[model samples]
Target: MSRSRGSFGQIIFADQSRIYNTSTIVGRIRVCGDHFTKNCYTKTILGIKKRKGGNVSSSFVRSTTKSGRRKGIRSSHADAAPCGQDAPEKDVGCKSRIVETSMPYADHDYSQRPPSLEEQLQEAQKTIACQEELLKLRKNRFFLERFQCDDRLIMFYTGFKDYITLMAVFMALQPTAESMLGWGQSLADQHIIRKGFEEQSPPLIDQFFLFLCHLRQGFLVQDLATRFNVSQATVSRICITWTNFLYCMLGSILVWPSREKVNELLPLSFKNTFPRTRVILDCTELHVKRATSKVLNSETYPYYKGTITFKSLVGISPYGELTFVSDLYMGSISDKEITQTSGILSLLEEGDEVMADKDFFIGDLLSPINVRLVTPAFSKSNRKLTPEEKLQTQEIARLRIHVERAIRRIKEYHIFDRTLPMTTLGSINQVWTVCALLTTFQGPLF
Candidate 1:
């Protein structure tokens, strides 16, 4: 029993420690964050009293030694708890806490404990072991390094094209596996790319496979990085490099045919209905990330997309074969300017009719070349079109669906489905070129 100097008397706690000074005691009640457990408490827990009519019937006391370190506790209180904190239960203790901040790298807990020398050594050894395993996997072999347990792996990553088609593309790009064994010999002999000082990187087949995997599924760069056990930057570099490589190698596969060739391969549907039509052409836009530079924003902004974009003129043959794909132009350019500069008009033969949407007002542009521009009828003086003009527009619309389908096929390659990144905008034209050409692999557009 203890007494104070004034009218207050001390209630002696037999086993529990009482608050030494009432006014001096820090009165802080905490609600435990752990809903899964009742035994969570603040780091510093002060003893509290449970009273009925000013007499203490029971006391919730947390004790510590002279060292001032709290011990394990297992008790629950009926008294009110502070915001976001709960008193530990009578059956559960600090030892039963779901999140023990005492440990290093606790999950969902920001608490961190500095590593000891032994832990640091173990981590270094683990890193070294991983590096050694990676080196073993990435050794100079081909065809079965990164993936490729079977053909299913190929289709899952590189689209639904057959293995033969995939192998053809791979071989065309690789040309000689011998070059893959060395450096740039495959592309160097072909002069597609010059040789450079080789860096220790993944094999050619693996790189090609990686590129295909990215294109086929449009996986995020970070995901590819983790899959390949490399950094996102490395995955990005591989994507850009292989994008250039595949586009350069495979682009010629979908070449614009001679007039005779185009005529010979024309599907009867086009030959009978739209005989004079050589190519259906239109301008398409791909939304890209907004640039920080005002000039860049203005240059890339297209009113159609209501955002920054890259505009390309797509020309498809009568049977849906891509006749030509132009380089990406700034969205700011007029359709007439793009048509004149895209080298598309040059591909046109004299007397060839260019079937297009009404927006492609290039009849005067085509007139000097002896080429014709055919589009739906336009109203004059605010009057409706004649019946003949309406029938003509229906015919053109029915035939023009093929070009739209061709564009849809290109856009199906998910990379172009979303807002493109500005960082890789330099290589985006190549990516676009590749996607456009890949439609050929889908076979005759009919």
Candidate 2:
């Protein structure tokens, strides 16, 4: 037996002893196994039959079957054999061999066709909608309800004593806020500017909460927007609207105590040392961002603070209520000038005494209004103060410290701790005034 490759690339085993000598041209032979046929021979092409007048190529091989007859190899049909009953079957002495090969896309083949662009887009839209719903579910929807039970959180976030007081103030302001045409809206237009997007604006109470958060927390507009789930523009509008609204609403209330009211609330310490004191005045400076213009820079630069600042005079009743907050002036302005221009003198009457720090040289200004100035005595000509003057200075110092405490309360808002941006210049005065007034709600300073 010998093994060789046939022209069709199939392995062929032939018995050399059965070879027959014949003048015949044999072409490639293909053998397939078949069990149903007796002869087991299907269509066959014996290459080319040799004839007397026909030419046979020498490259062709000659072979014969066991009967010593020529056998053809090439078939006229070039198509592959089908695997069913209709295909011609051939029988050989061997069983059929099963060949296994790896398929490249076998595991990756999909049962259905890939989705089209429209289908994918629709799926993405559905996912986004679901995500939005989940976000809304996770976030607390009501600002007031969320903090109503937590007074510390209310204080931390809005500087209110508790939810009750917060709501009380809101209730007082709500009527005017609801009745107004809108934020800075004209009476003729009759259009009210809503706090947020029309479809998703927070309730009026929540809008008030948002504004309080902005003021007390000193949160940026973007931060308030994110916390409230509104646009930055909406937060800005809310802040401006509420600032003006509060400036008008709260400012309408008279904070300056009258002479009898001051005497009624005056503390014993003031009564013993300075029995006639009406109010204690002090000058405080707030840091402000540098301005673009040279004139602004020069005018706002406070020599004491070494930075651009806004100067305001804060006056408290002897008992520590912040009775007066002067409009912000340039840092470069003198305390005497601020006192002269702050209009506090007009509010004072004869026999009313004003107590202040030694830096205030406004005794001349007060004298014209017939208001007495009580301040710590300064040594003159390097002379030591007398024992009585020393006791008087100590008493004045002890009594004047309350005004500093009042200023500290105002500064506790934290918004004034940092240098204010120039953009807030428009409403910063109102902000300062509102903060000063809100401290009255913190209970008595004494």
Candidate 3:
């Protein structure tokens, strides 16, 4: 009888040319020749057998009849398979080889190390030491450049530091004397002045030193000319050039501190003694030598000093800073007239107080601005003060002493303590302004 194979078991099919491919079937059955059966019950080719007591059944053959045909069948089976051939190969022995290669070997070593904190500190210290050494070298160079010996050595020794200190004190103090000498010397060397017989003039540094001594120590123009072996006209011209230069340049640097700043520096003692006091005001006489013209001399002549003089109003703060210095007024002018003419009276405001001597006569000028004037009590018709008036006068005097102290401090500068030479009035005033500015640099007196 003919047999049919089920699709659930292995089945082999061949084309007409005798090429065969194997496939598994899920339904239906087929038989190839008389020896093979494909059915669900078959486990292997050998498991197929003839059924007992039945018509002869197909026997499954385990081996191919030809070896080359078996090889071809195996090749066909591999080609037809749906899976298993593409699976990745396993590396069972690779892990240990990888670990061995990754580890560092004892034959190799690294010697690099980070710097320590001590090394870093030493480097920083060396840098700072170099900077300090450089600064010292620069200072030594500057000292050597300016140091010189001359006839003015004694004067220079006494005033050098003071002069330098004063120059350093105010940004407004011009180096005019130094600059003019430099310019004059250059001009002399270049023969630029008057186009005349060129014998190089004396060094300007020497002349500047002499000029400084004259200004600070009041050396006579004739004396300086003789000392420098120059004409008086040349000396006078040098003085004028330096003085004018200083006056213009230094004037801009002498800025007054703000009233608020002054108020902040006021001492508690001053505040308690004179409440709401704005400034301590006083007028001082600066004597001048006699002039050649009588009319000119009379105009400058001050009856009180019996010599030609000028009047200036000096105002000091509680901290002893020179707050204000009025422009020069003729000595013939009364203190009241000077105060009015100088525009100082215009600064008073309501609720402010100005302490002054009886010479100020500022009551009328200050009253309109609501400022109270403090002065010694005076009786009518030049009469002596009563007991109450005397007590008031004493109280005023006690409060007024602070301004006197401020003035005394200013006069301590020898330039102002002595009678200023008429030839050096412009220079002396400049010196005074600079000295006053220098006082502020010494820290607040209050």
Candidate 4:
């Protein structure tokens, strides 16, 4: 009467050993007879039913042949009784025990009986996920949804499209890039271009979209050609043509409003800070490759960049719109020279004030023309700026940031942000002009 209770037993039930799961079970409880009395208890197979709340109970069955042969565990009513019930051919004093617990994701070597309910549910879920992925669709990045989300994103990749007079109405409001892209698609509908000998390639929408990408991304002509599946010559041509096209389309659109117009439409930000401001002026530079000619290299090279660079002056209206952009100048040239010769001051009216950085010594120059220069106070080595001067500097800086942002928007074209090749230097002005005007597409800066 020695029972090894609560101990697991390795029952060599029927021939198959792998049909049961090793991990999916909660726990296994086994009952064994005395170790010394090997045949004292009947060796029989049983079925265990697991409940949702982690309760489990076992039922014994005569799952073996009467001839003393091995057979699989069975739960059929003909062979066994449910838990707490008796088996018809129970061993004289046999008791069954659980051997092991199961692990999650345990694979069951399915034998004769069907799989459990839990396993079936898992398979169905996986199938549904796959079917959903197969059925889903996505939009083209340039033509629809992506554009509407951020118009600035489209301007960065594909600048304003070829102008149609009616397009002015669409440009007046800041719509989602998607709506504009949709409108652009409808506008370019049925339009096409070709060269007689070449194989047909991607359409102009993609071509120009790619062109804008190349401009803002600064990808090389050879790389762009490969990406668009066009020849290097085509890439070069599109770059030059589109640069000229955009400049022609957008460059002349920026108008220098009269002083009265400026006062009438002055935004609250400028009105509160610098009411008399005609424009916020700032200078920017672009790095370029050293030129072939020594004079060209000498002229373009500047100490600030440690490399050849091009410099230009940018001015934005009080409402954060670009009103002026000087022609590209060699970096070595002084800002005053660019300002003097660039003809920007000629646009200013008497009594108009130009807000600028502290560096611009254009006050004496503007004074003669009856135009005033508003700049941050200079901190001389002999004496620091007074408290009042410091406060004026902060206010000026606050207003000046809008101009810096305007310049930043110009550089956003990315082409301006990269090292310029000598070949493209000829059209750098067009590139600059296009980027400046492209700001309109970015919605109102204010």
Query: Which candidate number maximizes lDDT?
Result: 2
Candidate 1 vs candidate 4: the lDDT winner is: 1
Worst 10 residues of 3 by lDDT: 91-100
By lDDT, rank the candidates, best first: 2, 1, 4, 3
Model 2 ranges off by over 4 Å: 1-142, 184-196
Error of 2 at 76 (Å): 59
Task: Tell how far residue 246 is off in model 1, in angstroms.
Answer: 2.0
Residue by residue across 1-446, what tens digits does model 2's lDDT show? 22234332543433322221122222333233211233323343766422332333332345679998888443211132222335335222222233322334555446678899999999999999999997777557547677789999998878888999988998998888877544545776554544334547577899888887777878888888888888887787778888888888898999888889988877788777788898889999999989899999999998878999999999988887888999999999999999889998888989989888888898889887788999888898999999999999999888888889998988888778778999889999999988888888887677
Cα lDDT of model 3 by residue, 135-229, tens digit: 87755531212444332443342244444443353334334434444324565564455543223333444544555555555667787777666
How high is the CA lDDT of each candidate model? 0.67, 0.75, 0.57, 0.64
TM-score of each: 0.60, 0.67, 0.52, 0.58
The C-alpha stretches of model 4 lying farther than 4 A from their native spots are: 1-156, 159-195, 198-202
TM-score of 2: 0.67
Predicted candidate 1 versus true structure: per-residue lDDT over 1-446, tens digit per residue: 12122212211111122222232111232222221222222233355522222222122457677898886332343232321234334322222112211234435544667789999999999999999998886653333443444567656676635667766766766664334322224544555433442343456767777777788778888887777666776677678777776677667574787788878878787777678788998888888888889999999887766778889998888878888888899998878989999988778899788899988888889999999888988898999998999988998998888888888878877777668888877688899898888777767677
Instruction: Please list the Cα RMSD from the true structure of every candidate, rounded to 1 decimal place.
Output: 24.0, 17.9, 27.2, 19.9
Q: List residue ranges in candidate 1 displaced over 4 A.
A: 1-156, 176-201, 231-233, 252-254
Question: Judged by lDDT relative to the true structure, which candidate is superior, 2 or 3?
Answer: 2
lDDT of 4: 0.64
